[model samples]
Target: MRADRLISILMMLQMEGRMTAAELARRLEVSERTIYRDMDALSISGVPVYADPGVGGGFVLPANYKMTIGGLTTAEIQAVFMHLAGGSFEQLGIGPPLRSALLKLLHALPDQSRRDAEWIQQRIYLDPESWSQDEKTAPYLQAAQQAIWEQHAVTMTYTSREGHELCLKLKPYGLVAKAGVWFLVGETEGNVRAFRLLRIDSLEGKQEERFVRPEDFDLQVFWQEWLEKYESR
Candidate 1:
């Protein structure tokens, strides 16, 4: 969390041009003293950040200074890719930046690291069926996650257990894949619904408009409730 906080601070400074230590602490939910310490750490480590105590001064980095993760070890690089693989690369907004970052990481490695990375990929295989209703749906799981995270609506045709079929436009809230099936939880108009990905005929989404996900919502709680309801049926 500390590392993530530091990265966020740096990025905030980069985006906002300048930010006071108090403001940084408030944003990161840390003490002003901690922000000072983090700033010191960044500056000493060649970050080229500067902070001033005057009324109109705060941390600032040079306009063209770019940070690169081009020195990670093979294991570190592989970890990055493995994390990215957890969701649909096509739909997650982080995918493009991750791909670019991955390329830099791979290019920075030595020849041995590159070979080891390939070996790691070959050996590290996931059994998607155990995680989903069917492994065939794994690729589209990311699509559901993306819609949820972006608050975009999704349109999919799903089949029911009783052999019924329906096409729906859902406000995708979250995705859960377990026991070899994936489910999308969201509301259609004002009704909550869950659809098994394996039964979905086609999936589509657009970001033309978005909605705010509820603040008091928890995916796990919703899931448990759904399970209880299912068992009672």
Candidate 2:
């Protein structure tokens, strides 16, 4: 645990440039004396960490200093890849980036750890799709995802379950994938709604007409509340 705490402290200083001993201690949930000892340990261990005395002084790393992904344990490396393998990132049209990142992580590992990680990948598997169900495809899923990421309004031609067609302008909030189905959650006419991705006949993102998202809007909370209300009815 001390090793982890020391690493975390280094990371904090790396990102923050400079931090007081009190600040570092508070962030690490340790005492100021412990922080001082940790700084001494880092300096002795060949890490370029130094403290400045007096006001506005704390630990500071060189401006150009950067930490590599090297210090990860073998088990940590395996866990990272395993979690990545469990996600449906590919279906969300981010397969290329995900694969690129995995390759980078793999390449960063030492030879022995790389082989161990590969072994773990070969032994454990993750299939995000549900069993014995027809594969669901949403033609507009990627567009909706992009719209949400860019905070843009989109004009969508949607058909309700009752077989009525409606064309509406929506301020895309987020996208949710459930049971192999994708849903687009957004705002239209001051009301938040969720539309089935499959039901969207056409989608055109209006990038020039962006809407400000509410500061308190949270995708997970919104999705949960919507699911609760839908299920209750």
Candidate 3:
């Protein structure tokens, strides 16, 4: 994720104007030495960054050099940030990187577009969790996310409705978040099913075993049918 970190540093400098090495190290959870190396990498890549020496000095990106997203209108910028308000990004352990990327986009937006996006962000609030339920945890969500994205199988022990611990090797096709809960939708036993990640006692990706996702599978259609059956039962 060095690339991501590098981009984050760039965006951070663009937004903050100046940041000390120690501050960047603490925020990024890396050593100060790593920050120095990253700065070198950035400079070598021709990014216009420099260190300010003396009292109250820090890494600086010039104020006059601005990056702007020219094609996107103010309305489009609003739409992007509005979709980002839901809490699902944090559920899958993607909150930090996702937010960082959003910041990058927000910084690149034109002055008026950025103002509108910030206005909507301040006014609107979204809570995806259900009022009737407590928060659910899915410790294996990161693993499931990796497996699904790489088209690999996952080995896990799933707690069945009958309270039996069943071993499974699942080829994850997609993951669905419903009512603030995460579900792993995958192929097992020659059938597609959804497994609640909380019920998974243990999970690991089978990196050596990859599978082709069914080309005809429609995740939305399947989820609708699955929901109907669950409700009827």
Taking the tens digit of each residue's C-alpha lDDT, what string does model 3 give over 5-63?
Answer: 88778878888889999989977999999999999998999888999999999999888
Off by over 4 Å in 3: 1-76, 129-134
Task: Give residue 128's lDDT in candidate 3 (0 to 100).
Answer: 84
- Give me the runs in candidate 1 sitting further than 4 Å from their true place: 1-33, 50-61, 84-104, 110-116, 127-135, 138-169, 173-181, 188-194, 199-233
Instruction: Report lDDT per candidate.
Output: 0.75, 0.85, 0.86
- Give the alpha carbon lDDT tens digit for every residue of 17-124 in model 1: 889988899779899999999998888878889876688998888888765544446767678667655434333346588778767766766778777766777778
Q: Tens-digit lDDT track for model 2 on 1-233?
A: 88988899888988888999888987788999999998888889988988778888888988877888678887787778877884458878788899998988888887888888888888988777766444456788788888888898999999998999999999999888775677899999999999988788899989999878897888898999999998897
**Model 2 residue 228 CA deviation in Å:** 3.7
Worst 10 residues of 3 by lDDT: 66-75
Model 3 steric clash pairs: none
Error of 3 at 185 (Å): 0.3
Could you estimate the TM-score for every candidate?
0.51, 0.67, 0.62
- For model 2, the stretches where C-alpha displacement exceeds 4 angstroms are 1-63, 131-134, 160-165
| lDDT score of residue 104 within candidate 2 | 85
Deviation from native of the Cα of residue 44 in model 2, angstroms: 11
Ranking by TM-score: 2, 3, 1
Superposing every Cα of model 3 onto the true structure, what RMSD results? 14.5
Q: Residue 200's C-alpha lDDT in candidate 1? A: 79
